[model samples]
Target: MDDQHTPADTPESEERSALRRVAGLSTDLTDVAEVEYRKLRLERVVLVGVWTSGTAEEAESSLAELAALAETAGAEVRDGVVQRRRKPDPATYIGSGKAEELRELVVAAEADTVVCDGELSPSQLVHLEDVVGVKVVDRTALILDIFAQHAKTREGKAQVALAQMRYMLPRLRGWGQSMSRQMGGGGGGGMATRGPGETKIETDRRQINQRMAKLRREIAELATGREVKREERRRRQVLSVALAGYTNAGKSSLLNQLTGAGVLVWNALFATLDTTVRRAETPSGRTYTVADTVGFVRHLPHHLVEAFRSTIDEVADAHLVLHVVDGTHPDPAAQLDAVRKVLREVGAGGVTEVVVVNKADAADPAVVARLLDEEPGSIAVSARTGQGIDELRALVDRLLPHPEVEVEAMVPYTEGGLVARAHQEGGVLAEEHTAQGTRLTARVSPELASALRAYPDYEGSAST
Candidate 1:
């Protein structure tokens, strides 16, 4: 968690002051206190991380992402530091000496908050805040804050609130006399006073629990409504495809290009929280519904995942998943792994995936070529410029599951509606009007084939 800071005058402080001189700070030192209390925004933040694995470049890339997240949340990143460690320190996240160095850095930079790249335990959160004398926030909380800011719909707001409450419940802290409350204070005046003091924490916990219960009920009600819609689509025999990938990876752009959905598209992270479904047809005239869902990130909060289960269920139930990746990103491989991890967590791992490297227009062609070489079947496309879109559509058409039953039926004019229904729901290879009624050859679902069983077969030889 990131928080405020006070100036210090030590050797480490002097060292940080020298480092700051070379880096050249952007925000004024006097404005730090004023910026800390600004509502609806977090300004002047310092980033810190422990590099446990990977090479130096990977560590730098991760911190760069953290800086971008902070900026997206309306914070100005002053300075970022990564400490080399085998693992994160248990009490303060970074080692004690490094924590002291960080405190100096915060003071030298006049940052109001320190954002960590990973989630911190309750003890670590408290310890770090005390050492740095500022607000401390982990990656999970920052992401949740962004979600809360972007959530617009009722269900989206409910999920964000539920996730925030769950994250806050465990990290609740008390000060002053609140910590002295009695666990059981049911008695006359004197004893009751002690009881109220002891039950203070319990009361807070109870209130949070109640709110959580209410939010869960609301979310379940909303999910039931969505399920009804999904069931309706299933009954119509329309294949469903879901678009999923890292946040800001152009999933929405692709959806708009494919279906003309005109969904709100912004370059910011988690710009669209609610799911958007649009009907689209493949090149072969096969109809399907494509749904764009919330994107994934590394170390996505578990509570957030649980809260959005219903929205993500679209991916699990989909016939195909378009795993879109931003080809211009510095670390596409890591982004792919993060997205795959969330998909598996949501039980969508077994679904067939078509890797689509989007944004080819802005990406380095050499890098795109290397990625395509590595992933033999993956396709590269520019959603904005419409490059390779037709090829993508053709691929999707080819990969979609075809109907199993193929037969020719001759129905009398009195049952002409059956022939029309077949034309709508199935792949009609050929159709002709005959003296009897209508002669039609189509590839259709088993249920539709059964319904048409009573119709007389065409006497002509049937084509496969």
Candidate 2:
């Protein structure tokens, strides 16, 4: 968690500050709820969820997360309610009886919106909204709105826009009979149009499909640039570590703390959408890359996963994954499960992972102890306080993969570039000065080994 700062006067700072209004600030437990809702611009919302599975505590936590998401989207959560059920009612999600109950709560709470904890079908959304007499938003829509507001980069904005369009495509609604009319120029509008003509909903869907196709092509082009950079790093034999975890798990803060990357850190969920890569060094000065990617959430919108597939590959391709868990969150175990679920979905389930229990200073001692016990070898560290960071860095160095090829060579001083590459791309096992040049023995990539082998006079033993 990071403290809120006053905005500066520059254009860049102004943009960052405008977003700050939507990003919630970290606050004490007593006033944490108030901190998130203070800037709400009359978007009062009543939260509703159906507890189908899991314990009562998990149900409560899920709704709590929904409230946090609502607040993050600039909505005030007036009240929350959960209905017990074997499964969600197909028609209205929470059923007619509970819908009425929710209506009463919304009316009493003076909320103008009803936010559901699950993704509602188009019909369910309409029925529930009609019964509740307010604008109803499901979890998927709420998350998409947040992404739209927080995305800063061109790629990020394109991804979010594509996702929102996908979600809205099937839910295109039309008013009574007005949108059911035939097109005016239907006489020459072809076979189907010559009959009843194209309806308003049909026209809207066609336009949306066209727009979606264009967006897909744009996103693909942007992803190509990202792939090029990733491939370049691979050619250099640089190891990459990606941060993967639940939203607001203090990943950005941890990244800044470790490498002084200066990324913006916020206390809000899904605050960072664009992937940020920073150069990092281990205890022995071995160079590797650490990336702060978008955070995961329970039931994250499927459209988002599809739209951000290119970005999510950062984790799948990483040499190591730092699975950061918010030690202070009420249900850390559930958070862990949620993150790993998405990891598996992205084909990153088998990647080497290091569980990092963050916010140790704020987390309850018992909670931290239990997490550490459950996740053996997990490290408890506070980005805010710099606790246990040295140990964590050393551990990362030991766990990361090293170069496979080893060699010993003495080269002329003109090849000092090779020495630097040896230190950066691989490990320097030994080094000594010599009259001829520098004698070195180290583990290196096969490509680097080939380069080093070019020197005939300074040749030495080579092994896999």
Candidate 3:
């Protein structure tokens, strides 16, 4: 994860003072007391995956990422294995032979847990557990575990729980060691060492599902408020531009550069899961809202997407998207495709995209050259060095929506409200004072133009 997603800030320092508003920090366990306590300790885990396609190197990289995720979730990866299969076996995920091999690997490594690289059906999970005689978790569960550990805000926690419950719903099994408690009945030289069984797991699943429903209602209420906020911005005609990219693609770095958002740019997957928006001014002196959204990844769990639909909808509604890319990534092309796939999944497929190849300072020139050659209009820049930023800014100015009409208007001094609204909601090119009224040359949105037309004192002909 360190090598994958580092802070993309430049040394010349695009850093700015922290803003006054406190918002969107996740409620994950990062805030828990650091003192010694009796919480669960990290366990030894064996990583497993089935390779259906892709080069051996690609498969290895994917497994390496899974390892990083395990570490992030406070697990030690003891060993790993990959089984080549066209489709994961319904019963064991991997073939039975591979399962036996994996069991041996776990025993050899003394691993307490097995983590799979793909989501497994409930039956598959139960079968695998029975075969391996260890805790079996699929990729979605692992990702959710990471989210549960990392979420810091109330909303973040609620969302993570909702997603987890949805994923666990179908996988609820009738038997589990965590369920049946030892009844301790039959004694007399023949004591039974019974354990928790599946019934408890089923009950837990039901409770989780109930809680999930409640959370959905709560989030729906929150979404109402969000919609109101969005409408307010729309009423103000402030163009919203969302920054989206693969996890740790220097999005926060670029946001900090463009808008002075002091978002913590860390070297970790899902560093900025919560959305951060800041006021930004383009080179042409037009003001707009810029939002840095949660970074995406390949094969992001579907439940996560469903749970985060409201949050991701922000991307769909954006007037323009700044698709940040790590120029130094081994496969920038693949990274770009992953992002695009998520965008399409979220129903934001047709939105305008500006491919931003970030980290120019550290990126291989050959990669940069090839990317530039392939993507005709993509901008290559070192967010840390501010290289090519000016050009990027100009591109932003060109891409963002603006007022359609350039006209001169005269208004009475008393109508300062109109004047201020014009400056705030529309682009005011020039202003002057005369004895009869205030003279202004401005570029105004069509909607604002209609509103101005209704004013009784509206004067000054169009400057066509």
The model with the greatest lDDT is 2
Sort every candidate by lDDT, greatest first.
2, 1, 3
* RMSD (Å) of each candidate, 1 decimal: 6.8, 11.8, 12.9
Question: What is candidate 1's lDDT per residue for 252-281, written digit by digit as tens?
Answer: 999999999999999888999999999888
Q: Write the candidate numbers in order of decreasing TM-score.
A: 2, 1, 3
TM-score of 3: 0.81
lDDT per residue, candidate 2, 1-464, as tens digits? 87666554456654422201112221123456675546545488888888878776677778889988988887767778776677888999987867887888789878899888899999999999999999999999999999999999999999999999999999989997748767556466765556566788888899999999999999999999999999999888788999989999999999998899999998999989999999999887789999999999999988998898899899999999999999999889989999899888889899999999999999999999999999987999999899988998998999999888987777679999998888888899988887877788889999988887665343444432
Error of 2 at 170 (Å): 1.1
Report lDDT (CA) for all predictions. Answer: 0.85, 0.86, 0.78
Off by over 4 Å in 2: 1-40, 176-178, 184-193, 456-464
Give candidate 3 regions above 4 Å deviation: 1-40, 176-205, 412-424, 433-438, 451-464
Pick by TM-score: which candidate is best? Answer: 2
Residue-wise lDDT of candidate 3 within 347-428, one digit each (tens)?
9989998889999999999999898888878999987889998898899888887787766667678877777767755678
Candidate no. 1 TM-score: 0.87
Once model 3 is optimally superposed onto the true structure by TM-score, how far is the C-alpha of residue 28 displaced, in angstroms? Answer: 24
Q: Could you tell me which residue pairs clash in candidate 2?
A: none
Name the 10 consecutive residues with the lowest summed lDDT in model 3: 17-26
Winner of 1 and 3 under TM-score = 1
Winner of 1 and 3 under lDDT: 1
